[model samples]
Target: MEKLQLQLFLNIIGIGSASGLLFKENSLFLISDNSTYLYEYQIEKASLEKHALVENPAENILKKDKLDFESIALKGNNVIILGSGSTKKRNQRISYDLKTKKIENKDFSVVYERFKKEASLSDDELNIEGLIITADKSYFFQRGNAGNSANGIFILNADDSLVFKKIILPKINDVEATFTDAILVDTTIYFLAAVENTASTYLDGEILGSFLGRIKVENFELENTILISKINKFEGITLFKESDKEIEFLLCEDNDTEELKSEIYKLTINQ
Candidate 1:
């Protein structure tokens, strides 16, 4: 496979880079797995501001470290944030409004329990990292680790009831791979997965690099793949069509360090 290079267009400092990334007009929201605050990155001013989670009774739901939110997706004003499929902390989701800045708590425990039983995944091993919701409320989730070299992608179709589907990823570089985030651009689904040599179960370790897979949404089959070797474990991905000839991407990384200095980068994908 030919490695795709990340053209470092710009790097932003601070903001306590965490798991998910979502853009709303001129503002970009980044969330930390270890914190309750949602960071708003002002593109025009190039500054970041934090917003507290006001979930009424469970006001600090996101503040607790167990939530382990790993992915964020937007369908109009409904910003859906999902936690990593930790069996101990499974089935947690938040729906936040971009315009009104309102938040609602949601549960999919029934589906999750069925998923665990069907997939035979252990309580602490459900490691979901990627989430994408279509306009009609169809859900697409990417599992970070599914074993050694193989991983799985899950889909929850909308019909008032849920229909489940799982797809496996082919081994990349003959090693284990895990996904962090995903997005759907038109008819295509693009996800960023990494092969990090971590020592802990869900903790970030010595990252060896990453892979970006391009799949078609209609057939839900892998169409193309790009090996991104220079960047660390990219925890989130969002696309922007800057022009007819090129596409722009914003990726955020989690260093898993004490200081929480998350890095941001701009990748220009030539169309």
Candidate 2:
């Protein structure tokens, strides 16, 4: 593994609890777990746009009533936003059409139930925090912060079928790290994992650290893992740029605060 360098890139104001990130063209799309709006940031102009994804009675939804949108994936002109699926109320899926600028909401409870059954997971053991969509398959990451410490992934097919794969993630500071977000780049899958000392998926814990790692898509095996930051609870990641020498990634932090500002970091990995 080569050396990695990380730096503070930008502080995005007005967005809190940013859980998922997607970078397309010159704009960056972000979704907060507690907010009903999807944020778009113009890279060149440094401007921000808020697109309401759902009608909320309150400006920020309460923790138990929030959608808990934890994963964001792009397919064609459509952006898929998924909830953590840690609770019944969090099983809603939201999709935004870039071309149409329309929002569609679907109840993913049945799909989440299928996931729990496929993995033989308990109700608290099926927290999905990351998603990766390919040409024909979609991968969902199940964060193992809740029950059984069962970190896994679900592969969804075009025919609405699923295959479950159990993954063993490395521990940070003797605490097991759970998947927070992931992005597919070429043949490898880059992921962001964080260590929070919480036994329940619905509850917040002590933020120990975060890790940047990669896994082989062919075999679903971990290739490398590196400690990125010991303080920031990074929950979302997207590919910023790639070249022959190095690859840059933009990551959003969910500091677990009421502050309306979120920090985005640039991580460069040498090839």
Candidate 3:
């Protein structure tokens, strides 16, 4: 694939750090890494609505106490949000029922522990940034931004077991790129990756660049990589629309701040 054509699609301000994105029907569902609320944006009306994930909604959750929801995926009528699992506090998985507008929370500590054991990852090295669910399996992407850890994809089987695969991602501008988010399109996995200078998951670093890449779901082999932006740290991506000639993707940026301003971009790829 050649360089992707990028455009400034939406400049959403006063929202938390946008980490996960999903689109269904006419609404855009987004989740922040530090907030306990899900944002629902109407495409036609350009209006934003906030639904509290917890009974009590707060504008911001402290970093130490935040659930750190990092990825969102759709399963039937449910929108599932997953935490990064870099810390014990970030081990909560949530499912939002679209039909009934109900919230269900699950403790993901056991699965996260399985990930660490299977991948040989330490506590500080495990950061799950992406999730993709199929009819019988779930793929959890582990970001390799932390200390000496390699990026990985953990496949969860129907038997409540995990099969881990270490991934080797290409470097961007001489900086190491790690997984951010991904969505499965047909048999291809389209993913977003970003480069940061920090070696610790808890610390923020300089955002060198971000890119869009593809991997074959059957063999887990990389196929293509395209530069999206050199400045924005995109942490989430979803299909906005598609046709025979072009595929449009919606990307949400994460600046790692409490300033309540974030940007989402539209990327067009010509087939």
Candidate 4:
């Protein structure tokens, strides 16, 4: 595996900490964990436009304590934003209408606990930080993590039910690795995982390194693994095809203590 380099795109301010990214139509959206609004990236002007999470997000969509929106997905004009399952906030999700610019309140809290039990995880271990819609649009893949075989994917059926799919990742240097974010290209599922220096809870771990793995949808097997980069903390991943075997990625990171600044990196993964 060849080491990939992250090119600095631009320094974004007021993001606090970016957790999810999505490219839909001609616009790109980056979600924040500390706020209820999304940073919409304007590719043509190379600028950002802030869009509020929902109508009166202050009262309905986000919590009064913290907004941990960690995943973003799109279907037509509807944009899905998911909360990281670190606490009770895991069940907070939204389907915002782009055309109407309004939020559709949908509760997953009822299923979050059941979803955790299915993954054989408790509330603290239910680290669902990534999400992607399936190819047939029948279900959504909810990425979960912990260690050993505890980390896997969850199927969010259209009827709002859940299914847990187990994934076994070979330990890196005898240390366990956990799942983060995921994206699907055709029938292949590309999931990003990291092995941290310490076993932190579902909140945020100190990332020593990260890996990109490919799993076939037919068998749900991890057929390959590739070392990507050594960023301290990798939170989200979104990709675009460049060539036959190469895909460009925009990896988001959070360094809380360092000047309170954060970055979004552009890189390419050659499969």
Shift in Å, residue 199, candidate 4? 3.0
Model 1 Cα lDDT, one tens digit per residue, 7-94: 5543455545478787668677887776656678888898877666533222123433456777788877777777676655546778
Full-model lDDT for every candidate: 0.66, 0.89, 0.88, 0.67
Worst 10 residues of 4 by lDDT: 55-64
TM-score between model 3 and native: 0.97
Model 4 sits at a Cα RMSD from the real structure of 3.5
lDDT of 3 by residue, 110-188 (tens): 9888888898889989999999999989999999988778887999988887898887887866678899999998899
Poorly placed runs, candidate 4 (over 4 Å): 1-5, 54-64, 135-149, 159-161, 202-205, 257-260
TM-score of 2: 0.97
What's the TM-score of every candidate structure? 0.85, 0.97, 0.97, 0.84
**How badly does each model clash, as a count of residue pairs?**
0, 0, 0, 0
Query: What is the C-alpha lDDT profile of model 2 across 1-271, one tens digit per residue?
Result: 4599889999888888899999999899999989878899998999999988877523467898888889999988999999888888889888999989999999999999999999888887789999999888999999989767577889999988899988888886678999999999999999999999888998999988999989999999989889898888999999999999999999999878878898899999986
1 or 4: which has the higher lDDT?
4
- After superposition, the stretches of candidate 1 with alpha carbons farther than 4 Å from their true spots are 1-5, 9-14, 54-64, 144-150, 160-173, 198-201
After best superposition, candidate 1 residue 54: deviation in angstroms? 5.1
Off by over 4 Å in 3: none
Candidate 2 regions with alpha-carbon error over 4 angstroms? none
lDDT of 4 by residue, 1-271 (tens): 2555567866766565677787765566888676677778766676777777655543112333564687887776788887766677556788888888887767777666777677677666666677777534333344434442267777767666667787876566666666767777767887777777555454444566777778887778888877666664666788744577677777777553323245877877665
- Alpha-carbon error at 177 in model 2, in Å? 0.7
110: Cα error in model 4, Å: 1.3
Candidate 4 backbone collisions, by pair: none
